[model samples]
Target: MKHFLIIAHKAHTADDFSLNDLPGSAGRMDILCRCVNSALFLSHDLRRDVQIHLLLLGEPDPGRVIKFDGETVRYLNPDERSSGSLIKKALDKDSSDFEIRSTPGVTVRDANLSTLLSEFKQQGCSLYYLLEDGKEIREETLPRGDMVFILGDHNGVTEEEEAEIEKAGAIKLNIGPISLHSDHCITILHNELDRREKEY
Candidate 1:
């Protein structure tokens, strides 16, 4: 499976944020919504082997992880507003360390990046940190097994967070020299993976 973990550094963690203004009131949640769409959507259907996790660290409350499993997800559209609505519903529910399902194939939980990384490690997922200064992704042999890519939203991941991820054994990779939006990066990564798969 392909896993994407996006660090939404300033995305609002509460449902009270206005969906109508996801870019402002939701604290740049629109970026995350677009990431979700890019991660799972295809020309006519969703990618069943993909899952996207949004790590929200914003005001009022923080450290909420929203996961969308494309295998069984329903009611997810290609539009940003529709994805935002699903995210809002997940935030409305009470969350604990245990995941609570807000919609089909979507779950919410109270967890931090470190804990999630540990879990992914335990699951034998090959972790890759996406950054512009890192090694070019095409230079490495992409793993055929379960793999997870870590990326950040507009503001990008902080130095401390990058340290933690590297300490957890995530390999740093870059698509190109120029920095791109997190959502755009995902789309490019997916295309690369698709081409690789077709070659095999």
Candidate 2:
């Protein structure tokens, strides 16, 4: 399975924003929402092989992880309303590794990059950090095994966070010369993988 982790440094842990205006002109819930949409749906349908992890590093709680398992996820529509509701509910709760049977596909946990990377490493996932100046992404750069792609929000990953990722041995990768939004990056990566997979 392919994994994507997007970090929202200033995303609120509680649902206290306007759905009509998620960007809040200053907050990042908008970006997170878009990221969720990208991770969950493709061609207006669920992707059975992808797993998206939203690392919420915002107020009330940091190191909070919201996971979307496409294989078992249900009741998800190809609209922001569906995704927005799920995101709001997940953020409003205060727990570690909370699971909802009704929404079995989505899992929320109190986790950080270190813990997540460690778990993926144990599972034998090739970790790659997306950066603007990193090595270009190509078929040769991608691993034949399971892979995990990490990205940052609008503010991008901080120096401290970058250091932590480096410690975890994540190879730096760049998709293009120009920087793109988190969701756009996800789409590009998935497209590249899908195209390459079909070629082979």
Candidate 3:
């Protein structure tokens, strides 16, 4: 199964509240990119040969993008439905093993989307908290296999989105940055990543 990374908030996840009137589509593209970059770096460091791709499928230029090693970022235009349609098409076209990698900050918001994207994969879509500095990613500390889902925030999700995911048989998770010291968000992030790693 091919893997796709869809992150919603590079910085938003840590905020006490959601951003107001932000361009919803593009706001989390950076979160998505960071997700891929973190996972790619983790795979590389661990010498895992899991090839992945990044598809920026949406409107308004499909958002501006930047590239990191071992990842490709592109903007895709899906007929009228945007991401939902485009991802469905990609699933049919690829017709191979695939899974989606996302961060809770984004994936949880649209759990139905996560459910749809998982259909094409041998394993279900996996989500993670990508915590790193600009220079490196620490994957050994990340949760693996089925444990990724539990690394999400315990509260604050909207009722509508939560209902959809719960109805879909997927569990909601969150990783809180609020409890950590400013210089230690990444530290707490690493610990949280490790916590799940061992939980499984």
**Highest lDDT against the true fold, candidate:** 1
Query: Per-residue alpha-carbon lDDT of model 1 for 27-96, expressed as tens digits?
Result: 9999999999999999999999999999999986899999999999999999999999999999999968
Worst 10 residues of 2 by lDDT: 94-103
For model 2, state the Cα shift of residue 105 in Å: 1.0
- Tell me the tens digit of each residue's lDDT in model 3 across 62-156: 32112122223223221123332222233222112233322211121222234443442335545433222111233334325432321112122
What root-mean-square deviation over C-alphas does model 3 reach?
A: 12.2
Cα lDDT for residue 64, model 2? Answer: 82
Winner on TM-score between 1 and 2 is 1
The digit string of per-residue lDDT tens for model 2 on 1-200 reads: 99999888887766676667666722667787677778768786788988988888887777788888889887777666677667777766666665433266877778888888899999999999999888878834576688999999999999998998898899988888798999999888888888888877
**Total clashing residue pairs per candidate?**
0, 0, 11
Superposed on all Cα atoms, the candidates' RMSDs to the truth, in angstroms, are 0.7, 2.0, 12.2
Clashes of 2: 0
The TM-score values for the models, in the order shown, are 0.98, 0.91, 0.35
Screening candidate 2 with a backbone cut-off below 3 angstroms (N, C-alpha, C), the clashing residue pairs are none
TM-score of candidate 2 versus the correct structure, residues matched by position:
0.91
Show where candidate 1 strays beyond 4 Å.
none
Summed over model 1, clashes come to: 0
